[model samples]
Target: MMQTFLDLKAKQPEDLPSIIKIAFGLAAFFPPVKSEIRLDFFDDQLNEVQKEAVSFALEATDLALIHGPPGTGKTQTLIEIIRQLAARDLKILVCGPSNISVDNIADKLGPFRIPMVRIGHPARLLPSVISTSLDVAIKYSSGGMLVNDIRKEMDEKLNTSKKTRNGTERRKLWEDIRDLRKECKVRERRCTEDIVRASKVVLSTLHGAGGRDIIRQNFDVVIIDEAGQALEAQSLIPLVRGPSKCILAGDHLQLPPTIPRTDKTSSLRKLELSLFERIIKLHGPLIKRTLSVQYRMHEMIMKYPSIGLYDSLLLADVSVRSHLLSDLPNVIKTDETQEPLVFWDTNPHGGFGEDDTGAHESKSNAMEAALCRYHLRNLLEAGVQPKDIAIITPYNAQVALLSGLIKSEFPDEFSEIEIGSVDGFQGREKEAILLSLVRSNEKKEVGFLADERRLNGICLLQNSHFLGTVP
Candidate 1:
């Protein structure tokens, strides 16, 4: 696939999308298709940005980009577009950076009874979609002799029953389908090329699309969700598998690709710029439609990000901002009397150090971890739901430390608290968030802590009571 992409790049295809334009420096310009397209399958009224995205997706032949801020209904828009495409008998391939994202779309569209298959290890997929798993496709798509026999028998029975309108004959045909379904379940562990060939839509991770058995297949359109988190090389794996008509939906401002190496000055960091971010930078904001109405955060909590990151484009949807928590008496002290954002200026007392994996990771500070526990205890004692609070840090070490501290300090209440790194906590929301900035040291070195996207991540999550530490 990499060789194919390189070869295509060398040729400089004339109809590639904006991302390909930035990648290969192609000068070809294909104007957006002006023919009007409408969707009778979807009934909901779309916002202006969503309507533009749907129009661009249907009109453009090469690619379309959707800039989805937090709570902007990216998934819903993607699902509607998929419905319109499927209605036209297009073969679509849906992909993402993780199985969760792929499964999410699959789950959303599965109830529509589209001929879709979620291609991944069965153990990793949601159980509700098991019938659409790759295993079921492999089990039922082959064994030509037996399959032909069953089809021939069904046809014979249907022909004979058409004259008599016999219920007994129809009952037998139904029995054959039930047996075939059972056979698919019995052979759930086997996988074959027939899976991708039989499916009208295949959903998988970026690397999962490169399976050796299904490499030769072609799709009419490919849609990649969470495109900002995928490496440029990773995104090409799916893009090269088919023609270049594609849709990339993600927020570049929230989280970029995670590069684990600590060599900040090395040229290898160039790979961290995702294909989504690269195209957005080259083409500017006009190339993609931004979903501006945010439904996740309170008006007060939405102020910082709207001003700093989104150029004040985000407007708080009042209907969704009705859920607010009662303010704590003295736990949060700010210049304004009722501000929900709290910044704890903790002293720097820790630094980055080597982990067991021989890589330098963020060091955990006992003071900050203890402070997290203190706030969590107060929130719970004040009648806040344990599940409504989240503890986030940029470092894996701090996640482990804070998780352990929470469990030990409040064993009975530990099960409900969600603790994880900021990357793991993306696409999730909480009523009260406690952020432990793990970098603390006398040298004033902040070590991978200066990226503004982390702050953007905070804006992505829900807001009512937010407690953050600054070193």
Candidate 2:
């Protein structure tokens, strides 16, 4: 076999399959595999918390919640646990409540031998299954269906496609068909089953896949990253899938379930309580738990958000091991006012007379432009790589604006820099983070999870002194 293989390799330049195999392998090289998907891991290598979570999760058929303070390596520990399980030959499915979460996990676990699935938008979940099964040629990028919402969206798209186009112009009619019209004949476009059945690892957002019958049967373990950001009811719906063992990881202080701040009183808060509280709610005692200790934040920057929620975790101690080399790389907002903030109002009624269209673009651009200038100068002064800096926003509109600004301004300086949202920025850090208050409301409202409400708060409530944090 060795001699035959050596002969094949010697003729690779002229041979069809040999050359192709070498090219393909070279393209990927080895990537960081999602550790959870791998079967074997050095259990002794994991910290005490990671080892406990892994042992308990595999043993308990119910659930294991790995909650912790911000900056702790909870996600990393889950990945390692998965790797250990893979070593033991257990198949696992990793998912999140959002697309960004799915993507982040997929990127981390790509090299493993596990089959994979990523469900985000309400339209893509079912369609993804359908495409993989039929071995359909159609591929979806974004603006697609999610697992739960796919049925309705599919019907809507189906109805939209049947409409008569007698009077429509050629270009208009062509564009409509190209985009799948209102009906996205997804079943007809691709192989749905093959995609889902072929992989051992599936990554999906929490918002769309819950209560869906298909996801329940495909994998053994379901891990929810950033568990706090999901509604209490949301987590409940997912556990029913095949009576699977659940693992939840999140830094609750940074953010909570998608529920409104006011809505924080009931289910979400109850769901978020430590395992002891949840155990009381269940028929028996709490299942199992884990806590990660590593900190990736600069000590100074950690002081702000850390002073509040993470104090009890001993994260405040500078003596604790940390991943960051510098604390507060750029501007330190010692005095809230000293913080360079750009607040823009797009609502016409807000003090700034709005031309809705350009105003959003303007506000987004100005704030990002300001932030970029800051990171560019500071990073170069400190001699850090341009890729090390990032600009994160609260919503997609700002991501688009800042993305555009970066392309237009320092296209060369930050060609690879990424723009992210609050959710996407979790478990990650950069030299600086410029948060944009895109939403406004007239009065203090407790909980409104959707972006529209947030927008209302930022655009309508236009009063800065409301939060009391602002003087």
Q: Best by lDDT, which number? A: 1
Residues 1-471, model 2: lDDT tens digits = 233334445653444232122222322212112244433445345666666666656655444566555445565677776765556555566756565565656655545544555544435435324332212211452223333255455455456546846545544545655564334545322234445444555565654444242343455666777665665445443443333455667644445445443534465545444322333234222433536354444344444344443443434334433323233345233323132223333332443221134422322334334444554455445544556555555556756766777677777776756566655555555533444434333332212334332322222111111111110
Best by TM-score: 1
Error of 1 at 247 (Å): 0.8
> Where does candidate 1 have its weakest 10-residue lDDT segment?
349-358
lDDT of 1 by residue, 1-471 (tens): 466467557654665544465444454335476665454547375676777777777776676788888787788889888988888888889989888889889998988888888888899888887788876665566553345565566566556656656688667766776675566444332335455666678888888888754466788888999998888888887776445578889988887887766566466778879988877676666557777887777777787888888899888777545435664333343332244677877764343222233236557777788888887777776677787789988888889989889999989878988999888889988878899886666666676667788778865686676788888
Clashes of each: 1, 59
Candidate 1 whole-model C-alpha lDDT, 0 to 1: 0.74
